[model samples]
Target: MYTEKVIDHFLNPRNVGIIPDADGIGQYGDPSCGDFLRVYIKVKDGRLVDVKFLIQGCPAAIATSSIMTELAIGKTIDEALKITDDDILEAIGVLPEEKTHCSNLGAGALHLAIEDYLENRKDN
Candidate 1:
């Protein structure tokens, strides 16, 4: 069963959309588990000004994406990179043991987005 926090997040997920001109973007999925997550970020003045996500999967994935966006907003790029699975699980209050992959989905997506932004910036 999903926890109250998970259910609440799923019912009223936050930052549940896309940023068309996002400074960074990341997408990740597990074909075996059928969970996919994508994160968008807008950075300003060396800080993460905003974040958005699109998730396709289970409750945990939804909750993770929602909470991850909330946590990443306003953080410096380096600071945001420090966000981990434990941080997400704590923010959501609880996660089903089997659904721990949701935390990874969140972290990996954010990390990939940041990496993409950095790489593209270097190319310019």
Candidate 2:
């Protein structure tokens, strides 16, 4: 049975969309599970000014992506990078044991986007 918190998130997922001119973008998925996630971010002055997500997956995946974006926005890149899977799970209140991997996808995608942004900055 899904927890009340999970239900709330699933029903009203946050930050669900894409930033047209995102400074960074990252995508990841497992075809076997049909769980895919894409995260977009806009950074300014070394901070995550805005964040968005586009997810094509189950409720858990959608909720995780949404919550992750909400957590990342307004955070400095360093602070965002420090976000762990536990933080996401705790924010959402509850996730099925087996569905925990979905949270990883959200966190990994966000980290990847931040990494891409950092690397691109270095290159430029």
Candidate 3:
């Protein structure tokens, strides 16, 4: 079972693509479920000016990734890093207990993206 918000996001998943010149990129996967997510981000003046994702997963994964972009876009790097699994779940409504772990996919990827940016920033 899925929530209405979840269904809406899943059916029309947002930010589904890649940024060839992404300032940062991150990947996260749940091996147990064979779900994988790759996130791309563009930063401007220390803010996430753009965020996108490509995922191989189910409805929950799609919806959460969709909402994660909505939440992270325009946020400063620190704020984007704070976008957590719970933050995503609350935004998209409830998922089945078994699928709740899917909520982690987005925020995890997003955090990694930010981390990647920070790490690369040191080199620039």
Kindly give the number of clashing pairs for every candidate.
Answer: 0, 0, 0
lDDT of 1 by residue, 66-109 (tens): 99999999999899999998899889987778988788899899
2 or 3, greater by lDDT: 3
Give the best candidate by TM-score. Answer: 3
Q: What stretches of model 1 exceed 4 Å from their correct place?
A: 31-33
TM-score of 3: 0.95
Give the Å error, residue 71, model 2. Answer: 1.1
Tens digit of lDDT per residue, candidate 3, span 26-73? Answer: 999965668999999999999999999999998899999999999999
Deviation (Å) of 68 in candidate 2: 0.7
Off by over 4 Å in 3: 30-33
**TM-score of each model, in listed order:** 0.94, 0.92, 0.95
Two-way TM-score contest, 2 vs 3, winner: 3
Please give the lDDT score for candidate 3: 0.93
lDDT of each: 0.89, 0.87, 0.93
- Give the TM-score (vs. native) of candidate 1: 0.94
lDDT value, residue 58 of candidate 2: 84
lDDT of 2 at 103: 89
**TM-score pick, better of 1 and 3:** 3
For model 2 the local lDDT of residue 109 reads 91
RMSD of each: 1.3, 1.4, 1.3
Clashing pairs in 2: none
